[model samples]
Target: MDRQTLDMEGARRGEISSASLQMGEDTIAVQCIATMSVESMEFSPWETATNKRAQSLYASFFVINLFFGLMALAWGGLFPGNGSSFIALVIGGVLTLLGFVLGIRAAMMARRMKRRQPYYRLVIGASDGRRIPLVDNNRDVLMRIRDVVRHKMDSGDREIRGDFDLDLDLVNLNLPTEAQKAQTLSRGPDIVPKSRQRETEVEAATAETESEVLFDQDAEIIRDAS
Candidate 1:
């Protein structure tokens, strides 16, 4: 199969070979994969439909109760039927209060439903106990990668290459500490420019000469003591 570049730290300039999965600068051998799974999370279609129906019911209930409450209050106020009128007024007030409460609840539920979004997560477990979790908004892309990995592991393919544009920010992997960062900086550049080759060589030679001089001075001191 064709090799794909993954803008990842471990893969050569984000390039992945068939034998391993590159995560930043670390490689996870395909053969050592013990478990892999993809999970999708979203509001179920049935649940969504049911929610809509319930919202509508609440709205209908609110309107019906509110209308009846107003009518009862109007009858009690206009006709002045004494005891019967008092009971009507009490019932009307209760219905109106209940309607208002239900209306508010339906409004809140609608707002929450509007904000919901689908999420997909892929988790892979290695034999060495490393867990790789990949989360994405797109289900198809996540599933495709999972399928490819499964195929390679089962078929014993030597080459696994694919073009993957994954958001690095979504990955919650361990990051280097300040000490590691300082050590890396002290190590200097891995590849020096050709133009600086002579300067680099001169610097190396000068360092070696200084080390030798220090060694000679130590030896002379030891001889004097003897």
Candidate 2:
């Protein structure tokens, strides 16, 4: 049997090598393989579809009711002082109110559907041959994940270990503060040249030495005059 083989003999004799353990450790590194953007429809396909259908029904009902209400009002105006005209006016008013209510309900439902839409998902590839999916509706979370993966890759660590939670609240805490971000941005090269800075320092030192020597000469002249 080959040393690389993890057969029953190796298990029975307890002869597992450190190399195998290292290989297992290597498999646990995390890598970002792919990403997917989850829209509202994709996040809850059935729910979104149902909501859309309901919205359409409600909108149609509103339009129909509005048409009937306008027609009834016109009819009532044409046949003034009749009992049927009074009834038509009342019925039209009720329908118009009902249509308004339905329209409002539909608008509310549409707003909710838009709010529940997911922003994106990350496909994390682990060294252990497992692909884990991390999803969130916040763009900030996606940006943080991208930064983490880029840092890991730049450091030559092709794999990431440990469990990475996809929760937005949890991941959001890891984001850099405004001050930290500002500091990072300020790390760019300054406008002044290094050579100019060195020259200024040298000139200042020479001026200070000359001032000191002049002071000593004045003290000597005072002693001679005394």
Cα error, residue 168 of model 1, in Å, equals 17
Model 2: lowest-lDDT 10 consecutive positions: 6-15
Candidate 2 lDDT at 183 equals 83
Candidate with the greatest TM-score versus the true structure? 2
Give me the runs in candidate 2 sitting further than 4 Å from their true place.
1-47, 111-120, 125-132, 137-161, 168-226
Give the TM-score comparing model 2 with the true structure, all chains together: 0.42
Best by lDDT: 1
Assess the local accuracy of residue 59 in candidate 2 as a C-alpha lDDT between 0 and 100.
87
The per-candidate count of clashes, in order, stands at: 6, 6
Give one digit per residue, the lDDT tens place, for model 2 in 24-65: 123323233333332222343224456788888988998999
